[model samples]
Target: MGEHCDDEQVVVKKLVNKRYLLFKIDLFVLSFVCLQYWINYVDRVGFVNAYISGMKEDLQFKNNDINVANTCFTVGYILGMIPNNLILLVAPPRVWLSFCTFAWGLLTLGMFKVTSFEQCCAIRFFQALFESCTFSGTHLILGSWYKESELPIRSAIFTSSGLIGSMFSGFMQVAIHDSLNGVRGLEGWRWLFIIDFSITMPIALYGFLFFPGVPEHSSGKSRFSMTKYFFSEQELQYARRRLPARDESTRLDWSVVPRVLKRWHWWFFSFVWVLGGENLSLASNSTFALWLKDQQYSLSHRNNFPSGIFAVGVVSTMLSAVYLYKVARSRHWHVATFIAVIMCIVAIMIRANPIKPSVMFTAQYLGGVAYAGQAVFFAWANIVCHDDLQERAIVLASMNMFSGAVNAWWSILFFAATTVPHFEKGSYALLATSISSGLVSVWIRKLQNRDSSRKQKLSYIDANDMLDEDDDDDDDDDEYDDQIAQNHS
Candidate 1:
């Protein structure tokens, strides 16, 4: 009787321990990813702050050269994204991603010596190349660890960290400009890069030690090594089954590409995120603050004010994450996108109209919620594609790559140097895209719901003839895999 009682106690203790572990991976792992993203944005924006502080004068950048530099960085990001994702599949994210992080930190520190426009452009180019791994890579990590129900809010929290980073950069710049302007004979801009590099070094070291490579390839005694980290028993089984057995070999099956691309959901998400990407560029790139400073606003006011947009982003993202987690099964993502579209339209309207700076700030803050919509949208894709590994990867990368490519030109053409204070054309384009984004979101949700219903029907029929149907399904999957491999070859 005492032995049985002790066994009961052990079981209870295991259950309790698992419950505590429920949120550990999400909280710490997500926060770690957020810190990386935060630092990524901080480094990207340090150049912007430096430009405002006097880097433009010291570097003798032409009026259009800053735009040229930004364009170059975006180009590098776009070029690297797809290939980097492929490499991520082959390499453990921990080893490759941490190395990338450290390399970029060193590159960011090297920004201190950039004296000409060409030098600045070159560093920014390589910086974007190295830093491109964090965004979609984190999304992939979140998808690996969390269930569909738990993904949206977690991903939003992750994405919002970038905005938080952007917000914090303003405060950090203010402190740096005031305190480090001429310390050690280095100018404020030099200190900005130096400090930015310093902040990321520790995070990279943490990642090297901690980040689980891929969910299926976890090493012994790490955070995700335990069975409790998976959402369901079946999920744990699925992760185990993804790895090859002792007699089997693990190789890149190039054939998975067509299977991924053939899905309608992939294209829909890519299109949706293309619009969503514009929101980040408009708000998160320090454009609003830079525009305000260009109009001669005091540095104190400029720094303090733009952060309100991130505050709004945090609230909206948390709310949307909760909403999706609760009602995503019913296909309610369009509702969130609809609301974001409306807010964006209102922002465009305010930009078009002459308004008080405070009112304009309010408009921009409200529009910041649209940024959360992108997070929700991408997380939704991860949910829809959760069962298909290659599909999930391709969809996530394509969404970001297309968005980056679009924003690359969009920023130069619409939100150019001359469009400050109003950005009439840019506002109009945003308004148009906002409306289109809402429409596409609604349509895609409808299509996905239909597809889900079809899949559910098929599952119900198969359940009645379990063994026969299971064998057939396995055969079908193998055949599909072969077809995909052939297409790739």
Candidate 2:
């Protein structure tokens, strides 16, 4: 009875500890990353908001200037993605992420002072260099702490927060332009930057003080022992042990390059996201706003109407996450295929050049479904590459890096600012990329199935070999026993 009671107590205590650990992680780690990413999008889209509001007139901007600034930002974002993700291997994420957050916040604040398109492009480039850390970095940290079952929803939540930030930026810009414009001799657009900086700095400090680094490196003895206050020693040990076993021997040195390049993971997943990133061009390029501006809508309507697209994105992303977690169970390819089909229809609708606002609105909102790919594909990559820490980090970074590189040109070529209201070429491009992404997703599923089968076969062979050895030992023991009996007789 005592032993039974003790065993029950142990089980109950473990259950309690797990719940507590999850609560702390969700509160400190998940919340901080979401907020950081939220602000990242807010700052990123602030320029476009400013452009549509007054920056274009103030800076004497031309049609392609927005694309030029975006391309420069993409260039910086691409340059930083791989290197920044690699840095997380050696430096603590708490320090590195927070410092990057702070650096970009300052740059965002500096945006208010820009006097020329040239200056705007220069500032956006540097801002993107620092801002590049949040997306893939947070995915890496989430993979470190959460189980496969727990990851999809959290990733969805993290992603939806950015869309929410985008939605908020539109409304916030409208509000700032209404209230703060011409106050203290600063344009309403300039105040947007100042306000974004204010919202950003507190989150940076929060990350510095409370964000736990990865489980493998989160010892209380480290200089950034802040994680110690948030997690007990036992809980920290649980955090590490609960994750899937990884090759602890793997380091982020030059050897990782060959190891990564030799694998199908790097090539296929990177290509997957390259297509996935282009799939996002319709919403990410602010095409809806451009369409509204071309239609001669009021400034408020220009900002507010585009937000509906982001609203649809938030809904689609959460639904995909829930479906993946509860029903699909890591078959994220299903969601990818569905998104491609929906986007194809959306592209066709817009390409028809409908005269009604209702048709355009429907097409634009449906394109938001493409954002679901962000959560689905990245979660899939994290699960597939869970065994190798360095490979996982590199793969995630490479996926985003290569996508950003392609997007730098793809945006300028296909979705340029000049191709507003109709964007016939851009619409056709979206159709092609969406179909390609779906096809690649199927290919990834086939490869994953092959790898799983191979692993199963190897496991079965090892088990049979062990059984043979045991049988031989038993036979030898019986023979020896018989020999002893004969001697006694």
Candidate 3:
């Protein structure tokens, strides 16, 4: 009993130390990563805010020109995914991500110089290539720092931070429109770019100084040595010990091609996000702003009204994250989007038959539930592919990449700003895509269950027990599976 008590005390000591280390990670790492998302979102979506505030008038954007420019951002987004993942692997995130952030801020300021649609498109394409790392790259980094159980809410918080930025952009635009319209000899919309650039510079510098790289590589690197100020060598070792062993680092090679192709994860997760992103078009493409524009609401309304969707987004994203955190399955990830699909269906009904403005607006607001799936599916990918770092990186990036690939044209086909009032075709497209996404989620669950069962049957054997001494070997996955089952807590 005395020995047992001593052991218990040792375990308690470790837990206390581990909690301290976790608090530091939450403070420094998650906070900066979340800020990166928030700023990236503000800069990325601020275009629409500025557009509605005054740029549409200044730039003389007509017909579908806004849609065309937005498509260029998505094109650059898709192009950046694979390469950005490669960059994160080779370079410290402190350098790679912050440089990208700073570059986009510079591009945001460059918006002031653009006088034509072609120039605007060119700038957005480059800005997007820089900003593209914010989402998937953070997910890749988050997966490195967090255990599966701890990830969902953190992912939710991170995902919702971008929504908060989207929400803030509207209010910021409204404020700028009122106060800064003619300041510094620039239009209110141009001032928006100037202010956005101003805000992004400090954040870029902050990330460069403080962003902690992943634990596996942090030790013994000249760049990361200073990070020891926040976490001691002992705590860093504990951070590693608390998680699974790292996979061997290998150079990017053709060997990864066949390995990824053989796996179900890369296929299913990537494809699901593509459909899900399309299905969420109403929120993704700023349908509320479009509706306000068609109704000829004032600039104030355009800037203030779209924020309602963003507000709904916070609640739905948080609630959905809580549910998925508790349940811990990709099978349930589609629920939020499914609710949005119902809203789309109801929206179609209202459009076909005349309804009060309040009723249709309510339906559109409910579609913010679709944004909740962002945290859900991304967290799911992290949970399922927790063991393989490279595969996880590729899969996370591909999920966003394929989704952006689809979105490159999704807005054009469905949520084109010109189609704002009724958007009959868009409603139909969303309905179809949402249904397809739900089916895909169900299929992914079926596949996971099949794989889990096969692995369980095979887990009874010990690979290590049969191995010879001093030979390099793979860790037994049975232990990983068991720990993972409990990680949802």
Candidate 4:
């Protein structure tokens, strides 16, 4: 008895240590994912800082040229998404994702040597091409490890990386502008690229070793490994009923592309993101700061102003995720779009307000709140498409790719140089896109409700049929077995 008790104690201690180690592994992976996303955004948007610094003069860029370069980068970004997602299906995410990080980091460093408008556009386009894999791929991996109940918070945490990156880029740029403008005869913008690239290297290396790939294949353990603590064979069966099945014979087939192409969910969510991305342009592009400067806001104020938008965004997103999860309802559409429409109106009002800096600042922060729906919409897509892993991954990438493609020409055409300060065309597009997205959200909810009802009816019929078949088999087996038993006796 004493020996048995000692053995039991040792086993419990080992189990406890395993659980602790697993949690640490998950925490490390989450932090690494967040950092990768942060660096990706910083590299992508560092150009905004470079542009505001001495880049435009050095490259002799016209405002049209600047818009064109952003468009180029976006085009490459759009082109890369679908292919990268397909690769994710076959390849371990850690390998592809790490290689992508290293490639983009090199591309960002390459930006320091770019001398002309054409060279800047070229480097940015390829950098975006390589950088495109991180966000959607990371989100897909998040979905693999987490359930629907855990998703919104993870998404909120993931998206906060971008906001933090945006905010940090501004501060870093300001610091570089102040301290490194003439360091080593290279401009501060050059230093921005060098520093940003350097930061990405270590992060890429860390991720390569640590990120858990897919759920069943994860080399590192996670919080969910606690299943070993409480689950027995009976409990495992009950849990398996709720979990999705794995198809052992499944191949990496691309023929499913046409079926995916026909899904209305993919298109509607894509449209949702395009609208979400319009709000992003207000922050993503340096357009807002340029517009503010044109309206005579001082350089220092311009630099400090946009950071508040992201700060508000971080708070709004976290709260929104919590609320949506608690309520467990699909009313996110109305909440998100209504705020977006309000932001556009406020922006228009600010543009019309010829005198007050304070009003415009308030409007921009409100706009950021409106824009928090980007996270909601993507999370919404995940929920809607959770039944099929293939479709879910494809739809997520499609949403982002379609949005990037639209924004490429969308930015250049409606938000060109001559259109700045007012951007009459872009403002109207925002209003229209907001309305369109809202209308589609209602339709998607209807479809989901219909699907739920259909599934219930099918399940009922299947259960009834199964009962009838069991009754028939039991009657036949008993009668034949009784005759056979009497003959044998």
Best by lDDT: 2
Which regions of candidate 3 fall more than 4 Å away from where they truly are? 1-16, 219-226, 245-251, 327-350, 353-355, 456-489
Q: How high is the CA lDDT of each candidate model? A: 0.71, 0.86, 0.78, 0.70
Candidates, ranked, lDDT = 2, 3, 1, 4
TM-score of each: 0.83, 0.90, 0.88, 0.82
Kindly list the per-residue Cα lDDT of model 4 for residues 177-288, writing each as its tens digit: 7898898999988999999999999988877766656545543333423323333332223222323333335345765676567767787788778877776665566666
- Model 4: weakest 10-residue lDDT segment is 458-467
Give stretches of model 2 more than 4 Å off: 1-16, 222-225, 328-330, 456-489
Could you give candidate 1's per-residue lDDT for residues 99-142 as a string of tens digits? 88899999999999877899989999999998888888788778
Q: Evaluate model 2: give its lDDT.
A: 0.86
For candidate 3, the TM-score is 0.88
User: Residue 1 deviation, candidate 2, in Å?
Assistant: 30
lDDT of predicted model 3? 0.78
**Tens digit of lDDT per residue, candidate 2, span 159-276?**
9999999999999999999999999999999999999999999999888888887777764565654777778766776677755466778887889989999889999999999999
User: lDDT, candidate 2, residue 79?
Assistant: 93
Q: Pick the winner on lDDT between candidates 3 and 4.
A: 3
* Candidate 4, superposed: residue stretches over 4 Å from native: 1-26, 220-251, 296-298, 328-330, 354-356, 456-489
RMSD of each: 8.3, 10.3, 6.5, 10.9
Predicted structure with the largest TM-score when compared to the true one: 2
